[model samples]
Target: MTIFKRGEKELALIELKNITKCYKIGQIQVNALNGVDLSIENGEFVSIMGPSGSGKSTLLNVIGCLDQPTTGTYKLGDNNVEKVSDWQLSDIRNQFIGFVFQSFHLLPGLTALENVELPLIYRGILGKERKKRAIEALESLDLGDRMHHLPTQLSGGQQQRVAIARAIVGKPSVLLADEPTGALDSKSSVNIMSVFQKLNQEMGITIVQVTHEETIAQYGHKIFRLFDGKIEKIEVLNESLKAIE
Candidate 1:
């Protein structure tokens, strides 16, 4: 559990080489990714950005082990992602990655605490241990008071925080977020970014998020821009910006 330092050289937590993905839909073939090569070290916060159809989400999925590339070598930690069986991929996702979506994806019927415990429950963690971790996760996000409220009872930012808590309760190695702030207002978006920043800086968690907004993108250490299914360029944000309150 070594955190990657700025000046040190170590194996990346995620590596993608010559990645290409194709989707066939009713006699039409769509090439979503084209030879994208990327690497992300542990404890790094990176953002992916692109125009519509640029494969930003596709790339995130590949890194999260949700989708296999049509062609490529994807090394996540120590596993060859593209060659693993479906069950192994599921296990990998559960053990190594956590996901957050724009919609927050909370179950309406469950309380915030219940929703946060879902991932642990899926892994056969039950009763006291599961509840303990879930409470800690909520407390970590400063949502301890809202733990008993349902999704509909909480504010947008609160619900998202609950979703984030659920993602982190399992203590996954990497967090893949797709437009996590897309559904929030400016203030809430900034708040969510601050939460992510705290997690990356304090908890030594690796985060890769797909975002289209430049202001939001600046929150990350490096912003990868993609076009036509290829990464066009990378912009490194200044270190001082990480001090945003």
Candidate 2:
């Protein structure tokens, strides 16, 4: 029941209450998440970090609406995501969540602009408008010159920029990035993180990123440390830094 100011209104972008996710493998039951409660305010940058098998990915899946919790409740804005039907869930995901993967999931045949336009096409936007917006998004990402290039012709960083252009073209409520720099080299990783930081600070986009790298996590305003299926600690680093006298 936490509220934050968003423009003229008070709103919460994401809310999770007593969330639990479990899996049954043959005779053994494994708990992936155990009664986790979290709330992310609008326009906040958050990072979830943990070791392998620490339920970090599970938590991200639940937050992204890609997977459901075994128990507890999740609300994205005012919508009860936990109760939504599969079709309805898909609709919510399409309209609300934008996801970026480590692998840069770009269509092989489509050019950069075309790949960025894919989500708009699925939403039934006309070709002209879609292309306009796609081009604008690419241009914003400094990929205007590369719009006609296929993914195979692009560098790793360029491909990822294309993926980011695709993610943002629809103006989704939350940007969920899982190890966005995992596949990039050190230089490319820095560039990608710089883009993320600029997006958060300048555009005020709500970004929730999951990463194992501490350097990457420092970019977030808040860090949630996960361990053994639970959130062990939550640190408000920006606030802490301000408090240091």
Candidate 3:
């Protein structure tokens, strides 16, 4: 449970300045994000909390490189997000951002190991090395024995673990999760949160998650509350729940 300290020691991994996102629908403009400014430091676990339609998901997309902002600047690592080409943006997403979603998003037909291996395969890694790394990622999440299980064969929490392993197999710099535990039961949600804590604290992977639940949001070092597409306030927590043993 450590709040992110400001000043020079904290290097910014995600920087947003006057970021805005708008969508046009039937002659009306919808503002999903309005002049939002944010900074997430390396190794920090931050949560964005808001009601539905508050732009949390849009903000997540901008941070994850899934979509570009309508205006303002976004800097991720050394790349200026607004200035990068689409191809470069694709590369950035592949190399720097790991995404976890509410839905497990596992392929029903693939085994856990195979699903985890997809990212490495997309990067064109050799088959043997890919298999090794995928197995290692699953083992890190204590899913080593479930490597051969299909999504249907696993429990909800186990399937989420598989999804997490898949997200992390490429060793991306930042993990972006949107309602990661929204679909899980209380016990499973806590398990997923613990897994996230371990990843952020031990593996040094920076995490930014969007959640509506207060209990889930407390897992992060800082919570950003959003209202009507604008950030209402940022609260630094005293401590995150200690990583589950």
Candidate 4:
């Protein structure tokens, strides 16, 4: 049997080796990422935290296949992302990754149900099946009653929930969230964190979130602190404890 199947050190779903990204700003060269090495296991919930210009968002984008590293290799479930074509990368991203952003990113004109169905449409799923899965996803997030509502009709939290439902409907292997609770109030933030915890624990979905809030980062199983484009520290939280109090 494969070591991965046996749950050994081999179950790495995302692996980064000496990853670097550099940007050229006129005559100046800015290094967004600098030889970062990391590994994320299947079904793990991890949070990335750092200050501005620390490359937290850059790392997230690299892991999500939204951007390519200038050097080094990124492997997602054994596929070398650095070698793949743009079309191939797009296919892989659509197949294995779901993304949640701070802005919600829902369509203004479409109803919540229709917005959730967009991913399915990209995968070529039919109308009936798409609607069915979309409804199921909305119900899972307790947004069943808001299915017919438009983005402007819902509250910020409700809109974010709709975005989350849309993200998970495709059943991707990893859910990449960038500042998911950035736009929410305290109560809504707690509710969203609870939902993320449930998804990570019950659904066995790998979650990688980037956030600047310490309170929000505490919800993750493991926390990686980034500084100046490199990882400075990592902390593992005890599952039994609610917070590191």
RMSD of each: 2.2, 3.7, 3.7, 2.8
Question: Measured by C-alpha RMSD in angstroms, how accurate is candidate 1?
Answer: 2.2
Can you write out model 1's per-residue Cα lDDT over 1-245, one digit (the tens) per residue? Answer: 23234323378878899999999999999999999999887778999999999999999988888899999898876567788899988988887789999999999999999999998988999789999999999999999999999999999999999999999999877888999999999999999999999888777788899999988989888999999999899888897555747
TM-score of 3: 0.95
TM-score of each: 0.95, 0.93, 0.95, 0.94
Show where candidate 1 strays beyond 4 Å.
Answer: 1-9
Per-residue lDDT tens digits of candidate 2, residues 1-245?
22233331256788899999999999999999999999888888899998999998899999988999999999888778897788877887788778899999999999999999999988999999999999999998899999999999999999999999899898876889999998999888878878887676667678899998887788778999999988899988764221111
| Residue-level lDDT tens digits of model 4 in 1-245 | 01122123346988899999999999999999998888888878899999999999999999998899999998887668877788987887787789999999999999999999999999999999999999999999999999999999999999999999999999888899999999999989888888888787778788899999999988888898888888888898877525322
The candidate 4 region of ten consecutive residues with least summed lDDT is: 1-10
Q: Tell me the lDDT of model 1 at 57.
A: 90
Q: Which residue ranges in model 2 land beyond 4 Å of their true spot? A: 1-9, 239-245
| Clash total of candidate 4 | 0
Cα deviation of 158, candidate 4, in Å: 0.6
* Overall lDDT per candidate, in order of appearance: 0.89, 0.86, 0.89, 0.88
In model 3, the worst 10-residue window by lDDT is 1-10
Residues 1-245, candidate 3: write the lDDT tens digits: 12233222356878999999999999999999999999988888999998899999999999998999999998776557776788988888887789999998999999999999999987999999999999999999999999999999999999999999999998888899999998999999999999999898788888899999999888889999998988999999977465675
